[model samples]
Target: MHSDVIKISDKDIKKPKGKVFVVYFSSISNNTHRFMDKLDVSDARIPYELNQELIVDKEYVLITPTYAGGGGDTKGAVPAQVIKFLNNENNRHLCRGVIASGNTNFGDTFAIAGPIISKKLNVPLLYQFELLGTQNDVESIRKILEDFWGEK
Candidate 1:
């Protein structure tokens, strides 16, 4: 681990700065939702739960589960909801980055959704968290957002 990375507890994660949004989709297990809970940002929303207007007014991060490629392969597919949302030309500009979740048991394919999103959407692959995420992962995410937003 880098020296700059701090370990934050669940209760101590800092909220994202500026007009940040976290769009996610949780299917099968609730692990994606559980990971979203670790975020201090209040703009967390599931695609299905959102209204007709899928375009966010500000820059945002997408957190979604890997729907395919769970073996030793590194190629993974994005969730259906996320793909639909991203398919909208209007909504594409709102995305700044992505965080993908997957089981480590998948080996090289674990959290492969991030790369797929990053490549397709032309955005950064910010982080890849294990199922439900760890407290350390949450803290590292907080730090990354802070740095990205130029916040202290």
Candidate 2:
């Protein structure tokens, strides 16, 4: 095990410093986790549990997978545990970023999870990106994260 940390000069710190959190439901494609890991933010990829403290945090990027007949959507269901976690009142005022994973075969299968996350996060939707790949999706996701976070 190892610790990874990078320190920037004071000049760099002046540009809107904020924490990042990822509310992920399922990482079947691992694209979300890959992006979050690249972000280097203290995050939680709970395909199971979420709590009030999660909402209180300011910088959050929630990623949820779309599903229908049992696949990316977690057995064709919207993991109620995550929904309950979002329903918390403390989660309001969250800064937004989103990444959705789904099959492009469906019209909007890969991009609809953001609204639900936005409502709960109470954020203005900073950016949303989608990824659709069978096994190579993770590599493509890294580029998207770089484009998203590297932007001014």
Top model number, lDDT: 1
By summed lDDT, the worst window of 10 consecutive residues in model 1 runs over 1-10
Q: Please, what is the TM-score per model? A: 0.77, 0.51
Candidate 2 local distance difference test against the native: 0.47
**Which segments of candidate 2 are over 4 A away from where they belong?**
1-17, 27-31, 34-40, 47-56, 69-78, 119-152
Worst 10 residues of 2 by lDDT: 1-10
Q: Taking the tens digit of each residue's C-alpha lDDT, what string does model 1 give over 89-144?
A: 76676777778887777776777888777776667677888888889988988777
Cα lDDT of model 2 by residue, 1-152, tens digit: 00111233435322213533456655455665665655554567654444433444554555666553323342332445556656665543343455555544444334445544444444323334445333334545444444444532
lDDT of 2 at 1: 5
Give the backbone clash total of model 1. 0
